[model samples]
Target: MTQEKLFASFLLDQTQGVEIALRAEQVTEATHIQGGIQKLPGSVDFLEGVMHLRDDVIPVINLKKRLGFTPDSYTQEAKVAVVSHFNTRYGLLFEDIKEVFRVKPEKILPINPALRTDDQAISALIKVEPGKRAVELLDLDHLFAGSNIDYTNEEPPHESTAKQRTYSRYVVFSSGGQEYGVSVEIAREITFCREINEIFRTGIVAGAIELRGRTIPIIDTQALFTNSETTELITDEHSRILILSAKNCSVGMIVDHIKEITTVADDSILPFPYSDNDNVKGMLSRLDGENTILLDVHNLLCNHVEAIKSMANIGNHKEQEHEDSDTGAHTVTHHLITENCYLIFSIGKNFAIEIKDVNEIIENDHVMRVPGASGCSTEVINLRGEVVPIINLRNFYQFDTKKKSETNKLIICSAHGQTVALEVDKIVTIYKQEQFYATPSLGNQLRSKKDTLDRLIEFLNDQEINEHVLVLNIHSLIRNHLQLETTSRQAADLHADQHADDTITEQAKG
Candidate 1:
């Protein structure tokens, strides 16, 4: 009962003091550690195997490479502990678990005077305060004593209990702070900040949300777990706006608002500690903290569900990803960007902008050069007569295309007003996608998770060659350059206002 003596008559000091003695059926959930393991369980690098639990699969030991540089080994920083006993619950890969106590038999003590037990593996000695700093208690069975294998007992299987369930869809959200869910037919509504023209500078859908009148893609789900949030832009009000739907476009998700959706029954299920992400398939047990969580809705169409039906026929206009504070309306847009540099070239190898927003480099006659295109789509300039969509930065990056001095230009852009022409080879001056921050998507177990811009559109079974930096689509290069000058300026202003109202009705019938 020593979970600090059974939560010491209650309130366990709101866990700020910490406590986890488990037994109310082992108190099943908790997540944070995030990594561990360097090579063990049938190695070959299934991501260095071991260090996952929520369906259990643990075995951690890096307490920061055994307290910083332990005889040299485990690296990726290390920090895993994940313990479970008799019924086995592996994972002791620590590099950082710092604290978690519930002691109380008078702060438990014992071996004093001499200290330093040869091989070292403390497990217990705690104290708390009387002199300050004395936490030793970490002998999760002698540091996993030996780590036996045979993960036999198998769990995480329940198909559909609670009387074979039927009906119950919840999708309330709120990240970094808490509140979450997964289905409700994966929530396809909740929009509000209309007029979002499009800003998907790179993917994970961070640019469309114009509500009722259409236009989707807004996904920022905490910027895919760690991009913090900035380029995925959407400002605030905590910026809600969900949207969802993926078998063919339906993405608007500028989240941070949504909050309710209930109806549990599958006997209030279990299994979902990151469920290894097969798109996080399923799991929604919470009949009041019953634990369980991996319900993700295929990372909300960023998994390339055919690029969400070609970005749902290109942002069915109404515009929302074009912020300015909603001026007098009309999909307003403006761009002359050039950061750290990346309008480079090649969809296969060369890509790394940070060169600093780049806004200067033009060699027109309206560009007009498209005898051959496709290394990643480029070369089709016309600038003034308008058609600009050139991107041959060294044959789209396959590199090796010389001769073109006079400062070799052509990089003009205007975004929503359309005007793409990125055929670089030289002209290397600026660099700054802010200054180097986004760089995640490592061992992701996919399951509904696209929100690039504050980075998060992972998917890479192999696209190496110095990878990670492929963001071209300032809204399909400006929807093929301003859908024909926005349809000939609204048909030449409705044919000059119907020829000036038929010459004032022929001067009032003469």
Candidate 2:
């Protein structure tokens, strides 16, 4: 006789009737509450007290608290589900448990993007009945893997399962007649469009959605590809919104429609051709003769992240202006010093740079290759009848070379009469002298000589911004580039000298 596959799910009264399901085999036992539940000390609030079950003590988790719900008193109908994963057994307290439902492996849907934010607690989704509510299939693997839980001693699931081939799941969707894919882990949930409140003066932010009391900015994926302000997406239709969590902010990407949810073997994914499209992380072919472009959600939200930050600064500046108007100005006894302004940009998610040693910004035109120059200074461009060498900062920063884009701007600057052009992805706002405050901690990092991250970071003041902007070592950067150029010239001279010596030795032998 063949065994049957089943999924046990429960209802959470606190979460507006949202149902969470777990694999039936993973659930060891389920018991009704009989006595008082003990409280735990020095633990997270969601950790319900240890209770005796089956002659052994097991910690109970308050499902409401774990899922960000209001605390509720335990009812007589409440039951606890004992589940174990990675050798750690824990009990999950539920409002009520439904009868076990028989489901096949293919019937379960990969978690919808609408419910996913930053974690993969809910692994799958299933429709109980047509046009009825959907139940979320919970993955204890991710539930315990979060910061709230502690299971440090247990070995990772991959360590023991290494012999078995693993495939990464990807959520495939369509955009502008092209297929796109995002890793199932990072791709949160798929949601329908809601009332989108248009934000004025913010770039790339198509609108904002008030979801579950949190305001998430929406970026029209079609607008991103077309580079046009007019996103013809009808807000009222059955528009699908792919919610992505990156940089600790929830961003909703508006796609045409979700095509399907499937898994692709890791080895089968092919590298994307080199292009200026950083948004396209990679590509893979589907069995149906179609290529799915893997989208980088982080890159798509990069500009919006910075823009949102700058918007906060603008808000602070306005507030400061209003406050100053309300109160009369007074002369200060201490002389206020103005700091040098800096232009900010980022290389990746974490690395950022501020340039004070720049002259003028211009569009990147045809760059001529300098054969004998160093790797970092191999390209030169003609600007106003003068040939200027281009500095590829990625080379010095050890970042992969990104393809050039139309939006990429070159910052021209000179030190000691030597000029160079730096290519940066996006140009952040200019920080005035009084906008930011510098800490000697930056100087300490450089003086210590132990850490590679030596860039100075200045925290913005009330009249400036909310976050810290990294102040780059422009002087050091230019100096290093010049040093590399000099070293390359010296190496060329040495090679020429060795060649001459070899020729003379050959002539004498002849």
Candidate 3:
């Protein structure tokens, strides 16, 4: 049988309005060009630059320029398509990604030899349904041939070393025209400063923003650093909120804009000469020959931590009293808040699952891809002696699968005696619900038979920001979303059978 082939389609030039497609298997991942590409000296014109993606630096090729076309400026919509060529990887810069589509072998029409040029890259044209536009299929091998770019021996040396010095990644941002950085470990995410509810008039606390039902205090970076009695709140398109979290506390610092996410070696950071300023940890030298003030997150947030915690306790007490007083009436509203700790993580959105449901959290490393895996279970990894299928929540949730960051974490969770790893963008924090606010009783409206989310709970974090977190029903997610075997024993048996079949096939070939 002639099987169907999948292709990822994208655009190189929006002006030309031509779609180009690449074999889906060749495309590993696509991501926005964050921070900007670092220019290398004496590089080719088509060789845009090397990008610091996750841990390893990969060379980014401007596909437009390579195709003998004028390259467009890198906009917010610009994306890099990371394509794997044998053991090496190269990122193809694109204007925007369109979609991933499948077509039968018959739909691919070969290009005429008369029309083909010696340096042509498009090997064939993909036929779409009646009125739709045709897509040009790219022959990556041919396109990259004669480029004189070495693809072999490009593996990062740190991967083979056991005692390689570790570097801390930082999210660098600007506040008051000065660049500052915070460890990516504590940096949750960067978001636009919008619709902040100015309920708090406390020093440096501008207000709070309600994010996914959670209220997080927004600290005015300018006011806090300048020691101003009042916060000068300014709203603009460029203003961004850098969300930082440690332990149970979460706060957002208003920054002018996010510069880049860069890695800095621990030993390379120069100590701040003045000891009186507890907020400044050290100075990190940037590639542009400027120093970025690395802020000590703990010390910077120390003053407001207690106040935020106290407010949460007070809110919880008041809420409990109100609930107790209204108990006499038959009310359908349910406000259930437990002291159980839950681990919060982000896929495309923030979700919280009971911490007890999680076995362990580990960095995503050395994941073995599984062919024809069911549902979102496209990969598997060996955890101790057990084979755990890795489930991409983003895929299951129909979110765009971007290039995996170094900070991406795999949550090993077991339910119904079946173990699986849930891949998440990053860990937000471990949250313990201290209080809960009553939400409108959705009854059965919010839930369906296959709903993975259980219920929503609104509470205050240590910063007293109202947080609404959707509690994930891990049991439902595992049982309903994951279409794998029911039990771990069944999964193990399946793996064994596949292994045996592979071994037998190898012996037969010999």
Candidate 4:
């Protein structure tokens, strides 16, 4: 018999009730934060602040604010739930935790589409008792990454077995006679492609289209599918634009036509072939013996834009390589590993950094704003009494700038012989050599464990790392990006320079 699991139910406000369906082993700590949370200056509203919990400083998140609810007054009755997964930890604030109940997996149901949004944080719904409103299930990973999740029933799946299985609903479309589908959750709404102001010389950007009083960039799906610079898409009567939301950015994709929404069981989705380079998640075989290509819209957009940027900088990157070697910015041969472990982390949906030069992972390091450092070089954090510069790789990498929460972490490492830190959304997983295989720089892809590296490349945009973690060259990161001094003494000088006005005033008075 399958073991029943325990779920913790809680109230966000006085009205709506929610539940976290994770196993008991998943929760690390659940208690009222002593002395309350300390607010950080300039932090986002959803981030309450950092709290010293046990040995680590944990970021406490305001669940109400995170869910777009009105801010609730602080009270001692509130509780903090610390959950850990993939070696990453975060805290979720609750107004009042209700009850812990054991439930068989089959009892949980997908929330009705009529009552949910594709961008909602709730992952599933559970019926605690008869005729009661189902408690929404929260997905902590999506919540921490500031990702929108859809957990509604579009078309109910055919249950073939007694075992519990998770399913996703997708909207099918076709272009160039080829069938394609995208998760209905990410694909917000479908509408006719009209009044699109084509931007000449903008590469793949078809033009700006007004979406609910806001102009957003639109990309041609044909260009994305073919991995080309641009494609002449006939946006006549049948052409439709799929509005997609990933992370904090929203984009529109021009498709021939959206067919219908269908539910497919998770197990039926097969990985794409190794040689295929398109942004396909999997292949779903239908009853009529036809297969539809599952599209990963987020990766499709990211890869197309990145490829254009890479091609534009072809000559510049080669020139920088020689300079990097001369300046000793190249990673030392001794630091390279053939068979070892890597710490994988993500900045946004598109890229995951593989840390080969990781020195240590620490939390609660107080970040001090650095003087004269603009853009990515924003602050210097004190790590074990040593000052290390903090670089938000998202800013350096030109990713979508979402509201950052306190749960974000600093990855400490040595770059150019200097200790530096890279701030990432979350630490995904620590993958050993056998778990992942390295390849020549390809656009971001995830490898599934069930299949070999070659066969699993087709499943690149599933957004979930299975057995194969994409190995990002840390050497390139240290050499090409992050211009900062390595030593704490040099960082201290920068910090002192930030307060030089006060020193001068004191000297004049003396």
For this target, which candidate reaches the highest TM-score against the unseen true structure?
A: 3
Which pairs, if any, clash in model 3? 213-467, 213-468, 214-466, 214-467, 214-468, 215-465, 215-466, 215-467
TM-scores for candidates 1 onward, in order: 0.25, 0.34, 0.42, 0.30
TM-score of 1: 0.25
lDDT of 2 by residue, 1-510 (tens): 344456666766735777788886687655555355667688887787776542356778887777776655567667787787766667788876554455556566796667785666777787655367678878887788754554233344576565565677666667888988887667555666666755322346675665544456677777776776576765434357877767565677777755554545667778866778788767886545678888787776676565443322221222222223556764322111112434556554223333334445566778788875666678889987888888776665556778888656677776655677877765554444444444345443234321323444564533565566555555665565565566778898999999999999999999
RMSD of each: 25.4, 26.8, 22.6, 23.1
Please provide, for model 1 over 1-510, each residue's C-alpha lDDT reduced to its tens digit, 9 standing for 90 to 100.
Answer: 443521100111122332212221221222334433335656322123554443346544343333232243444443333345666654433322222223467776655435735434453455645586444444444433544553434565477642465555455466656556667664544534545544333445454544434445555566655544454454565455656665645666555544443434454455556645564545665433434354566663444454344334332322323544657544633222221224343223434332122333455334444564334343576544666566554553244667655444555554555456665544321122333444455334211121212331122322333334444444443454235444666798899899999999999999
lDDT of 3: 0.71
Worst 10 residues of 4 by lDDT: 449-458
Q: lDDT of model 2 at residue 499? A: 100
lDDT of 2 at 41: 81
lDDT of 3 by residue, 449-499 (tens): 226665666645547887787777789877775653446547787999999
Clashes of 2: 7
Question: Candidate 2, clashing residue pairs?
Answer: 112-189, 112-190, 113-188, 113-189, 113-190, 114-189, 114-190
**Which is better, 3 or 4, measured by TM-score?**
3
